[model samples]
Target: MSNINDKIRQIAKETEPELIHIRRELHQYPELGIDLPKTHEIISRELHKIPGLKIREHAAGGYGLIAELKGKKEHGKNVLLRADIDALPLEEKMESTYKSRHDGRMHACGHDGHATWLIGAAKILAQLTDEFGGCIRFAFQPGEEVGLGADTMIEEDKVLEDPKMDMAFAAHGWPSVESGKIGIVRRYAFGCVGDFKVRIIGKKGHASWPEQTIDPIAAANEIYQHIPAILTRTISGTEPKIMSVTYMQAGDVNVRNIIPQDCVFGGTMRAVKREVLEKMKTELEKEIKGICQVYGTSYQADIRIHGGSVKNAPELLNGVKKSVADVLGKENVYIIEEDNLGGENFAEYSCRVPAVYMFIGIKPEEKEAIPGLHSPEYQFDDTVLAGAAAAFANIAIHGCMGELKEN
Candidate 1:
């Protein structure tokens, strides 16, 4: 165990420079959503550099790549490590030389780092095929920002098929924790996320005469105002849930004297529990219908309920605790007691196999705190790459050896 651990650390240290270079290169030419041709090319070129690995490209479209590394021992359980390769639609705000050249697109969520770390692990696992057993599947996924990547890959690419993964894992960079640390939480790590858009159709007329036409704008306002109260009353205070109206469109900019005929608004609904989420949806629909009825307006809603909360299977949870503690040191590993409100398509993958997703700390100094995920100012130190890659490599090696057992 100690010899393999030492080798893992050494390989991670040696790969730090290359990993940083790849991450910076990825940051400069950031791609958005599942339509990442250039990004796919770059990833394919790098993965091809490693020896003794079989690589497969997405036959349909988009930037989905799967690499399989076969160990010396056959018939061993296959494990998968996933990394999202899509960037956000935000423009880079940091003053780095590697800032995104493409405007309105940035790797603000540390996905670039995440992808690089997995590559580092791939290099290590490829070299240690003799010592380790089982197959390692590296899933470089796309469209994670919009929560469509995992489902598409699973359905179209048949990612979980072929070798049939026995276990899977992924990691995300967190700015709240101190640098060089990691966080592992049991059970629900992320909330269930769903999107909704409401379109209200009303009679358009002169703004001066409010009584002449039905006002969709008034109806939207009423519905928006009722959301907070309804959520508070329906879900318990201890439970975490949110319903925010992020995008609103009603009137035209050129015309101010007349009311617009259409009011379109959309937002997200997130909850830690499925029952609470269902209740919120039902109550919200009723409220919207009632408000539109009173205002004599017609409304239409498009709602999509995605994967639910990401729950770590009991076996994987305890095994990963030991693996992470072994690699990052017990003191640097902490157990998170609270649920993160963010959504992850990793939930979809977890439902099929035993899975665990942990966080890597990338926070800079305390006095000069960095921005959080999805924010324009968000970025992480490149040095954290070595530790993160080491942790992942350690898990893949030890988990396959059946060393990651419950105490």
Candidate 2:
């Protein structure tokens, strides 16, 4: 490894205590959505200690923070390193020292670690500004769970403008990948996220008198059953997609004798690309319309695709892989071929710029299987922070200096 890479690894490891402390503090007081006041304060307090960083506070409505670290040399290119600071609306079930104190709010998605890694990278990169070139934008985003933070920052605040980022990189915690390893996906890393709702409207009447009213429940059930069939038939079997009906509802349970005026069902839709989402939505709407027509009920359907797939720039993959290899090892790094339907908001940046989205492993040895990301029991050991920090810092430094190869 090069001297700078060695230095980065050493410093990142040495700062493990600091990283854990910050992560714990943030984890204890987890916040949700865009308005994260306490989360902002904690992050800002630590970032203020760094000298070269010029912090852009609350670029979005809430704590959509961006800290710019301009290098001393004018020889290289502008690069961006991003992280998220939002937590999910789930009560943490883990009985750890750093368990979330807030009710119904927790960093179950490992975003606390994500934020810590970026903060660690910022600290390390700030110390080595003379060793690099161009500028590094450390975007600490909020509302990543809602898939709106990056979009708002990029579109409204222009976080990537001014110097105009040449390359961008972001990483997420992957419990299935095991600590000390890194996973990379070429082209599309994950799929686009979309939410759809279907409402079946009908006249209300007593349940005993079926002929007196049009039943919306029957129409909703028919539409729900046809949804999965539509997906299976619309997209090819080779590139599978996901459509989960998270919720379905009708009249009050207290009054079972009365037929409800309306019934509603909604769920998430995911695909490797927007084309798949569009195809599924088109079929779903058609199915709903036909089913409602048959049941003599009117229907309303709303389907919106939130963002594009998290795509990696082919030009930057080699550079990123090399950076990870330097921090961990070539053996510890991998190029993942499969595409996941999981929604990641980092797509907001990658879809617009040359960005690489990575998944850092945190699977513990004690457990037979890793806890899912949004699970209440989700947690990662503190060991993975240093490696992630080292890799991120190295990527930012070398990438800015043009030491990293570009296709």
Candidate 3:
């Protein structure tokens, strides 16, 4: 086990140049959502260079790529290592040489680093295929920002097919943690995310005549005021949950004397448990409908429930904890009891197999604090790339070969 870890660390160091170039190239040319043509092209081109691998593209319009490294030993369980490839729709605010070339598009979530780590894992795994005895599938999925890419790839049977994945694992770059440190929580660390769009219908009339018509703006305000109460009442004490109203649109611009007939509201809810989430949804809908009825208005809620809480299987979580301790040392890994409210599409992989979603610390040294992800100013310390690559490679090798038992 020590020998394999040493070999992985050495291989990661040797592949440093390639990893840097891959990260820079991806950062410079950022694509958004499920339409990552250029991103897919670059990933496919690089993976095709590896020997004895079968590559397939399954994302809608060539946005996702899957590469399978066949095992030397026959009939072994399959495992998957995934990385998201899509960028955010934000203008690059940094002054780095590899800044986004595309206007209003950037890899603000550290996905470039994620892709680079997976690629590093692929290269190291290709070299150690003889030592590893099971199949490893590299999934470069798109549209993780909007939370639909993984679903699309799964529907297309990209990651879990034929040989079927026995387990899956992925990592995100954590700007909050210092470089050289890694954080692994036993799944369900992050909460589920669900988006909703509400439309309220009412009668428009002159503002001067207050009693002449039902006002949707008033109804929207009421709904917004009612959300906090809903959250406090419906969400149980067993799990953490949050509901927020983020967007509201109504009425005509620059029109002072008119009451708008329609109002639109959009928001999201986060919950740690599935049952709590279901309860929240049911209660929210009923409350909104009742409120609208009281105001003599018609209300329709178009709720699109997406990414669910990431629940790591116990076995996989233990294996990852061991792997992190082996690569980054024991003190660097910490178990977080409280679940993060942010949602990650990595949860989608849990549906197929026991999966682990971990974080690699990339906080910069000079800055007082690292910027939060999805912010235009967010950046990762490149020095963490080596550790990340080593961690991922070790997990892949040990996971596929089931070497943790030997340790």
Q: State which candidate has the highest lDDT.
A: 2
Candidate 1 lDDT over 1-407, as tens digits, reads 77877788888889989999999998888898888887888788889999988999862256789898888865467788999998999988888889999999999898889888988999888888987778888999988888768987788888888878888899899888778888877667788887889999999999999788788998999999999987888778887889999999998899998888979999999997777788888888888899999989999988767878887666777667777677778888888878777899898898898888898889865635778899998887798898888888888877777666554
Task: Superpose all Cα atoms of candidate 2 onto the true structure and report the RMSD in Å to 1 decimal.
Answer: 1.7
Instruction: Kindly report which residue stretches of model 2 are placed more than 4 angstroms away from their true locations once superposed.
Output: none
Assess candidate 3 and give its lDDT.
Answer: 0.82
> How well is each residue in 1-407 modelled by candidate 2, as lDDT tens digits?
48887789888978999999999999998888898999899999989988889998877777878999988886878888999989989988879877888999999988889999999999898888889778899999999887668888988889889989888899999978878899998767889888898889999999999999999999998888887688777778776588889999999989989999999999999888898888888888889888888999998889888878987888888888988898788998999988877888888788777888899999876666878899998886688998899999988887887767574
Task: Report the C-alpha lDDT of model 3 over 205-298, residue by residue, as the tens digit.
Answer: 9999979999998888998898877777657566678888889999879998999999999888888776777888888888789889999999
Candidates sorted on TM-score, descending: 2, 3, 1
Give the clashing pairs for model 1: none
Error of 2 at 397 (Å): 2.0
Error of 2 at 373 (Å): 1.3
Scored against the true structure, residue 191 in model 1 reaches a CA lDDT of 84
lDDT against the true structure, each candidate: 0.84, 0.87, 0.82
By TM-score, who's the top model here? Answer: 2
Deviation in Å, model 2, residue 304 alpha carbon: 1.4
Question: Which pairs clash in model 2?
Answer: none
